[model samples]
Target: MTLPVSARMGGLAMAFRAMAYWLVRYRRTWRGTIVVSVANPILFLLAIGAGLGTLVEGSVEGASYLAFFAPGLLAAAALQNAFVEAGFVVNSALRRERIYSTAAATPLEPGHIFAGHLIFIALRLFLSAAAFVVAMALFGLIENIVVALAVTLAATLTGLAFATPLAAWAVTVADFPQLNTVFRFVVMPMYLFSGTFFSVEQLPGPLRAVAYALPLWHGVDLARTLALGTATLGMSLLHIGYLTALCAAGAMIARITYRRCLHE
Candidate 1:
């Protein structure tokens, strides 16, 4: 069963509409969220990069820790912002506030609710990335102005891809305890092992396979390579495809779960 052309377009329009709603409504959070996410990456850069740079004594990359760390900090924003937005906002609305019931009663629908959440998450990731780019400029992490915007766009998409399961899972959670376990067992492992802070080469041979298996790995690879001015066009498209597929699968699964839960 293939979707008709008109049906596909209409579905896309609805998703876009849902996303737009969150973007417009959350403009007020911009200033403060930016402050937190912006400072976070910087703190990581300084604490892990400079602090550890002293201990390594110029052996890790034969360069300053700042240079090696800029990419890691950028990738960290993708993981952090996406996770925070998904866990915090989704859990609050679905678990704490029961806002979804109210929203579901409206014309927006559950799918729209999901889109709205992802849109907000995507926007936050973009802002967080932008803030890091500025910090990078101050710290001399970037020389190419073009790569800054590229990194942000990549991070935005990648954030959504890596967060797909968490976002979808948020819809069906009977309680918050599961979320803690998911974060501890699933997301935390992805963050630590997915080349977020270091090269995948550092992974043990068996564990190296896990790095390539993660959506974040593709995103981080693309972001770092492009930001460094080394990636090919094909690589860029591959990363884009990976993120798109994850988002689509997530939305589809979420729709199924939401419809079953809400309609029943």
Candidate 2:
């Protein structure tokens, strides 16, 4: 039977309430996160984009090395932060703190709980991405404010593409060590090879194929294309489609996992 519109709205209200729990908890710890979100990009831009950038000759994709590298780093940083939140934070809530278990006792369904947490994650990504873009602008890497905003949006999308699926898996993990293994083997390799620091074309054919399949490469490419104003309509659509599909699929899996975890 079709539920009434009021019922749907009520569920969404519950989801937002769940999201509020994270936001309120974040108030005490937000200062540290804000510092890292702003400082990390500036330091990277100085070290990698400015320091190493000078040693490299010629422009990359018609811009200076700083311009080329900043957007990729922005996307990469989003991915890393998203993973940190989705990995250890989510795991702790499930295993150590049992926050989800407590919430399960409330009126919120598993889907609402997952949605609420995912909403908070998206907010976190937006703040970090915005800060990174401001840092990019300080380096004179971005000319157009609109493009900078687009790059920030692209980075946030890139983060969600990884965060949702990782959160889904985090629901099932029994310990912290498994999360470390994922970071070491899965996330680290993607960070290195996903066109963040260099072109994926430089990789061997098989490695290049692997990079192409990863969401980060698409994210880096999309963000870089926006930052450089080099994106064609077709390529932009392709990248957005891939990232959006991953976000949707991951959210679905996360909902299912949350249901199983909470119900059990």
User: What TM-score does model 2 achieve against the real structure?
Assistant: 0.96
**Which parts of model 2 have CA positions greater than 4 angstroms off?**
1-3
**Could you give candidate 1's per-residue lDDT for residues 142-261 as a string of tens digits?**
777787788778877888886666678776788778878877888778778777677788889889997888887888878777666677999889988988899889878888876665
Q: In order, what lDDT does every prediction score?
A: 0.74, 0.90
**Range of the 10 consecutive residues with the lowest summed lDDT in candidate 1:** 57-66
As a whole number from 0 to 100, the lDDT of residue 62 in candidate 2 is 78
Best by lDDT: 2
Backbone clash total, candidate 2: 0
Q: Can you tell me which runs of candidate 1 are displaced by over 4 Å? A: 1-36, 54-64
lDDT of 2 by residue, 164-264 (tens): 98999998999789999999999988999999998888889999999999999999999999988889899899999999998899888987899999999
For residue 240, give model 2's deviation from the true position in Å: 0.9
TM-score, each model? 0.85, 0.96
